[model samples]
Target: MKTFLLRKVHITVCGRFKLNDMHILVNTRLLLPGRFTGVEWFTFETLRRLVKWHPDVKFSFLFDRPYHQDFVFGDNVQPIVAHPQSRHPFLWYLWFEYSVPKVIEATKPDLFLSPDGFLSLKATIPQISVIHDLNFVHQPEGLPWLTGWYYRYFFEKFAEKATRIATVSHYSANDIATTYNFDTNRIDVIGNGVGDDFFPTKEIPDLLELDSKPYFLFVGSLNPRKNILGMLKSFELFKLKYNLPHKLVIVGDPMFKLSEMQSFYSAMQFKSDVIFAGRREGSDLNKLYAHATALWFVSFFEGFGIPIIEAFRAGCPVLTSTTTSMPEVAGNAAILQEPENIEGIARDMYNLATDTLLVDQLKSKGTLRAQYYTWDKAAERLWDCINKSL
Candidate 1:
């Protein structure tokens, strides 16, 4: 390998470098503070670990808006704010398609890393997009027309243009290759990691009041694709069949029109048993997961189910869908049920709640399974991919 010494002090990779000093640009648009979505969590955690591990590389985080000091870089890292804050949909498209190209040209980054999938078509640098899923293509009716159209149109082009594609699961990679007609050989599978914060908690704090009775948890956006209505229906059936005294706890913000869930939410015969706890962060979320009887996440589709791993880490048994990437991610550690089988889902939930032996077995297996994923491991894989591509 060729190497170069810079400033008579620093050593840099010059030719066919194996993950040595290189200028890297990571898109931080999804990592906005106070808006910590799943993609944001992945981006932030992976970037943080990458910078820490590779001190010689020059890392630039490109953000559309000014970021908090906590997210600011260290010695070899820097933040480059390229565009003004624009939450409007049209402005967002314009910023990415038009304004971002200018920023890329100015930065002259070796590679452009986008965690949110789509990249500027005008960019000259090699691009890597971390596309989580293609739900918009498969379930277009679940999202707004414009949103689905944007994803279907842009993602295909992005996949075609990108030098290398990295996805959270093999299932997603296959879907992307099939849908966009891109070579699957160019796609890299880098699974997501669960943070250390999601482990089992010994003390259930009184502030949460989560232990008054057994309850099932569903911790994700209240979107149609998540199969929230199916889950609700299944829970209602489960209550009737088992006559169990339990509540259904939802812990995410509504991601779509509230009207979609109103009927199911209103039709609950045991309306008082259902609770919308809103969004919980940090220890609150961890505690909630730890105390849950079981986590029910039978979504219609997924690129990768990060919450499945989260529940596993928290020692909470998981009952997830067998569709898409869920089965792959959950393996045999979780109770996999068909997304359409409301009765089956309810049965599994009831079993997990009352079956101590089964619960223990699941917990043990899940903890072992969760050991395979970590942010450090993901960062290492990412760095290797970048180096290989370079």
Candidate 2:
């Protein structure tokens, strides 16, 4: 093993090559067992492709938990589980910011990458932080006080210290640059790719029996930023105005303020029309997306709306918010409405459900639009940025 002391820590390079071999350390903190989200999917797919494409480079996946045997990697890729699982915020900070640096020092990696954004300020390694969005900076009221403070304080500092930064969308990249006063030149826009599984399936049936009528699908956590209240109100209006027999299917586990959502549900005029299908995976979610009247994802803000792209790929007409990155991702394939406008949402829902020609047009355009984003392209761009930074 070839070892180098770049900063205070020594990193070991395992692979021998005629060309200069760069040992890269990637933070795999978000890859918890049985958990999947947009960020996890992005990290997993990008890492998988990066390892495959670059055989000359040595890669290490550093995790805070025990390694899952099922996690796939290339021959040159190694897994390093250095810390025990932690739940406390203080412990998490200590583990990542303190313990991780020691591990990196020992390993002596040529480049350090933190995909979830925050990096240890103590480290001297050439670092790249994928600061997905500055949501905490923009909408602090939507998040818990401590959590919001931590993100705003730590991430801004991380951006400044990091050698390079990557974001999921152009909107996010601009926001990050403006918020942190960092030069836009240091930030790279690497949009996320829709998973191959989300595309239209011939096996999926057209109409599902959640009672007799089809349902409107809402995927993602029941959080304030998701604009769930707006969605419910819009659905109530749609049901009352059109007398539609369809249920409103919500497919995500509640992460915060359960009591608030339950209270809202109780007060709904058409409460009986709502169905909570809590956290689905695999073929079931694909089926839900394919059979829906249209995906209702009117979020107030987002780094990038992966579900919008997923719905489009699944041949479902989308009704997403006009705010943030939703319009950027949705393009003309979706029915974009203001998040605060309940009547606009109701009108679009009614339009999508009643108008056959509009639905057909959106479906056709979406299929072609969704084809533009791919994991290979994203991975290739990310690799190019990392190589350039090196």
Candidate 3:
């Protein structure tokens, strides 16, 4: 239906505007020099493919600073450093309103592509904004009050002004529609993909110097929404109930509510059993996933849970949330647990550890499910979404 509508509209839009003259200005600020967070990963992988696939079109990537050559994906790509890197809320407003608009004026782009869901209200060009979720709107306490205000204020208008919207999941598409009253039909769902590196490894490789006990993996930022407290409590419960030799390895830096988690972690009797593997990436994270007994990612909300698929690709059993996009993404390949229910989470954790048959079944199901998502496929969908917006 979306493709039909897009193709019908593209005929008229394409007739008026020559494809030969199309120059796309992408907001590549999310593609920081070295960092590849969830959003960053999406932008990089998709943009790399888009640039390669469309040589006829020119892609002018807008960065906040002097970007490294690593981010410059191709020859037809022109990298422009926009002023005022938006680290703070005020800086963000300045970057979008002032710096981004200024470049749009000079570049005179045929269309604008905002990979991180933030479209400049000031720009007159056609735009496609990839909004992952409205989590900030739903859970205001997840961010600072001012940051929350900025998201609500700008994003409502951003949704209104965008020519089209692309999201990571159908759940997020509906959430954005209900929250901001946007048309759901205009939204395209472009889900996430796990890389080839995440596949099952026969040996754990003794990476990160783990003690020999089997461990359940919880990979996410230490935020309130991640339910870190729940993970800790559930791990403790699992330890007490079964007396298993499994350790809980949490791999991510603290954010959102660090102090609250810090206080809780200090008081736990099984605190020693919980290993803080810290923020890891590439080989370190992949190895961690491959070796784990199961993946525990019962977060409160997610537009798409990338780690669930990463675990799936690693042939790891998954224990994820029953709500939001988790059940949608995990399908029947995981053990569903209510994120808030400590007892339920613990039971699933225990079940995943003990039930070897179930573990093997989930692993088989997950590996097959994981095969469906790939960057090449996502990039093709994203390209279609971008073309429709024009």
Task: Note the Cα lDDT for every prediction shown.
Answer: 0.81, 0.82, 0.83
- Residue ranges of candidate 3 with Cα displaced over 4 Å: 1-20, 205-209
Which residue pairs collide, candidate 2?
9-105, 10-105, 10-108, 11-107, 11-108, 12-107
lDDT tens per residue, model 1, 118-224: 68888888889888899998888777888788788888888888988888888998998888888887888888899878989985733343448888899998888
Error of 3 at 41 (Å): 0.7
Question: What's the C-alpha lDDT at position 369 in model 2?
Answer: 78
Model 2 spans > 4 angstroms off = 1-20, 202-209
Among these predicted structures, which one has the highest TM-score? 3
Score candidate 3 by lDDT: 0.83
Candidate 3 local lDDT, 110-166, one digit each (tens): 899998988888989999999998888777777888888998898999999999999
Q: Quote each prediction's TM-score.
A: 0.92, 0.92, 0.93
What tens-digit string does per-residue lDDT give for candidate 2 at 42-133? 88888889988888887888776666645547767777665545455675687667767887777688888888887888889899999888
C-alpha positional error of residue 254 in candidate 1 after TM-score superposition, expressed in Å: 0.2
Query: Which sequence of candidate numbers ranks them by lDDT, best first?
Result: 3, 2, 1
Output the worst ten-in-a-row residue range by lDDT, candidate 1: 9-18
Measured by TM-score, how close is model 3 to the native structure? 0.93
